[model samples]
Target: MTSTAATTEATEKWSGQLRANGRRVTKQRLAVLTAVEHLPHAVADDVAAAVRGDLPDISLQSVYVVLADLTEIGLLRKIEPPHSPARYETRVDDNHHHAICTSCGRIEDVDCAVGHAPCLTPENTHGMTIEIADVLYRGTCADCAAQAS
Candidate 1:
């Protein structure tokens, strides 16, 4: 499908999700969702910039608010690496990990190594059941590695 069509479909899907959760769907929310869908692992500022392409008057605060709401509702995932701003993505509903480049701060999705939920087995759960395991692998990306070599 064309990019525009894909965006529209994604927007509709998110809209339905918001309504199903009894949340009001607004243009800013849709724009923020579309931005995160198109640019996975995007920081709040980057999402705001993308949203601004469609909504010139959108404020960064509005983008942050939408992102926080979407994440709280499980429509989006928020990844916050150490020493970095939180990034937003729509690729949730699975036990996936992330690889972050130290040099460029680029982030990419890494599927569960064992292909299952809660991919890692903890030695102890402190008397609590584990449902999800969030792991962040830090290293240089291909481009950065090549450049360094």
Candidate 2:
């Protein structure tokens, strides 16, 4: 498909998502969602930068608000690794996990390690039903390992 057609399709998708989530379809929201969709695992600052390309007057604080709102509505997923700013992604439909590089701090998605939702079972749940799990795997990525070597 053409780039213009692709852009229109994506805009429609984002608009539909916002409306379905009971949100007003505003330009800032659309821009923030577009930014996150283009830059998965992006922090707020990165998202702000990307949004500014299409919205030069948008503020970082506004971006933060949009990000939080999107996350709260389940349109985006926020992941916080230790000592790193929280990152946002559009993949909120599944129970997935992440792997972070210890050296460079690069983050990558890791599928559930085992069976269905909440892949890892705790030894005891204290009678509470578990719905999902957020697992963070830390290791040296290949580039970091290669650089070290």
Candidate 3:
């Protein structure tokens, strides 16, 4: 599908989701959602800049509010890496890990190796029922490695 068509469909889906959750659909929320969709793993400032292309007066606080609300309702995933600003993405439901480039700070999604959520099997549960697993792999990315060589 064309980019415009896909964006329209996504906006409609997000709008429906907001309504289903009893949240009012506002232009600011829609713009923030669209920005996150277009740029997965984006920081709040990045989202704000993208949203400004359509909403020149949107405040950074508003963007943060939208991000927090959407994340609370399960429409977005927020990843927080040590010493890095939090990032947001729309790929949810499946528990996936992440790979970080130690040299350049780029992040990418990594699917569970067993093809499902909570992919790891722990030998000792310690009576704790595990529901999700969060993993982060750190290494130099291809470009960074090439640059070093």
Candidate 4:
């Protein structure tokens, strides 16, 4: 019903997924996943800081490694915005787009109006079968718009 509630739900799913994927549920992965779950589309550096707060010994490399592992196992989604560091999210498996703020480099998830992966129907197949599509809608966010005014 609320953003926080939605995030908590996602975290729970990741927790179970880690166990399902034979992961030991290490503190570093938990910390990083928690940070990313709490703040969807969070950059690795921000997640590293958050994880460090809970795990004083967790290094930035550890966070990045854990993110890569989780993504490999389908527990997390990694998003890369143009000219920005990669971000992580728990919301995967949806054919969704992203709205990127050109001014501040903030990213937000935007669900595809169409159904399923490769939601957009390409004008030409290009002689290949598309499994997924990454769409980034770039513009100034509302906050940036207000700041400019």
Candidate 5:
């Protein structure tokens, strides 16, 4: 497909997603979502930078608001690693986990290790039905390990 045709198709897809979530499509929203799609596991600052290419006036605060809204509406997944700013990703439809590098803070997706949603079964539920699980594994990444060695 032509570049213009592909752009139009992607825009329509993003618009459909926003409308499905009862959100009004705007340039900022479109830019932010597109940026996140291209940059998985991006922080708000990274999103803002990516967005500014298309929307030079967009603010970091606006990116944060958009990120929070997208996450609340299930359009995005927000993951927080210890001592690191929260990151956003478009992979929200499944029960996947993350692996964070202790040395460089790089994040990568880790599929559910064993079973389905709420992959890890806690010994106690406290009477609440579990729907999903958020897991974060921390270790030095290959690059970091190689550098150390």
Candidate 6:
């Protein structure tokens, strides 16, 4: 495995998470993890595209498997802002939110107000388990706003 020290630190946390969730550590997981660490908020296909650069033989199916596995173990966060493909980010602990630019389709991260996991509690639980509460704020980004004005 091509191990970057920074990726290693991130993967260390993820490794603990995988074990806690009863998952195994593998090279595919490393590749997917490394890719997400490099490019947060990446779509599935985008991750596959990136991992392909390092592991040329890695199949798209393999990327999907890694993504699903990591997501299941809570090593990755999957964000599906409305009208967009799901995006993955490796930062799992902060309970951050995203802001999507309507004109440019760009997304940026905003650390949660509470600065911790499950940052906000919903008004109504409806008797469902809640592990996270995310925000997808929509507006024109600065560049788009400038262009309009």
List lDDT for all candidates, in order.
Answer: 0.91, 0.94, 0.93, 0.85, 0.92, 0.85
Q: Estimate each model's TM-score.
A: 0.93, 0.95, 0.93, 0.85, 0.94, 0.82
Return the lDDT, model 5, position 2.
Answer: 100
The clash count for each model shown is: 0, 0, 0, 0, 0, 0
Q: Is candidate 3 or candidate 5 better by TM-score?
A: 5
Cα misplacement distance, residue 124 of candidate 4 (Å): 3.9
Task: State, as a TM-score between 0 and 1, how close model 3 is to the true structure.
Answer: 0.93
Better of 4 and 6 by TM-score: 4
Please state the error at residue 75 of candidate 2 in Å.
0.4
**Between 5 and 6, whose TM-score is larger?**
5
lDDT of 5 by residue, 1-149 (tens): 99899888989998999999999999988898899999999989999999999999888899999999988999889998899888999998889999999899899999998858989889999999998888999999999999999
Candidate 6 accuracy as lDDT: 0.85
RMSD of each: 1.3, 1.1, 1.4, 3.1, 1.3, 3.1
lDDT of each residue in 113-143, candidate 1, tens digit only: 9899899999988998998899999999999
Tens-digit lDDT track of model 6 for 43-89: 98999999888788989888988898788877888999898898999
Question: After aligning candidate 3 to the native by TM-score, how far in Å is the CA of 73 from where it should be?
Answer: 0.6
The collision pairs in model 6 are: none
- Cα RMSD for predicted model 1: 1.3
Residue 77 C-alpha lDDT in model 4: 88
Q: What ranges in model 5 sit over 4 Å off?
A: none
Report the lDDT of model 4 for residue 54: 80
* TM-score of candidate 6 on Cα atoms, chains taken together: 0.82
Model 3 lDDT vs. the true structure?
0.93
lDDT of 4 by residue, 1-149 (tens): 89889767866776787899999867787788788878899988888888888898887888889999999998888888878888889888787989998998888889887877888888898999987788999999999999999
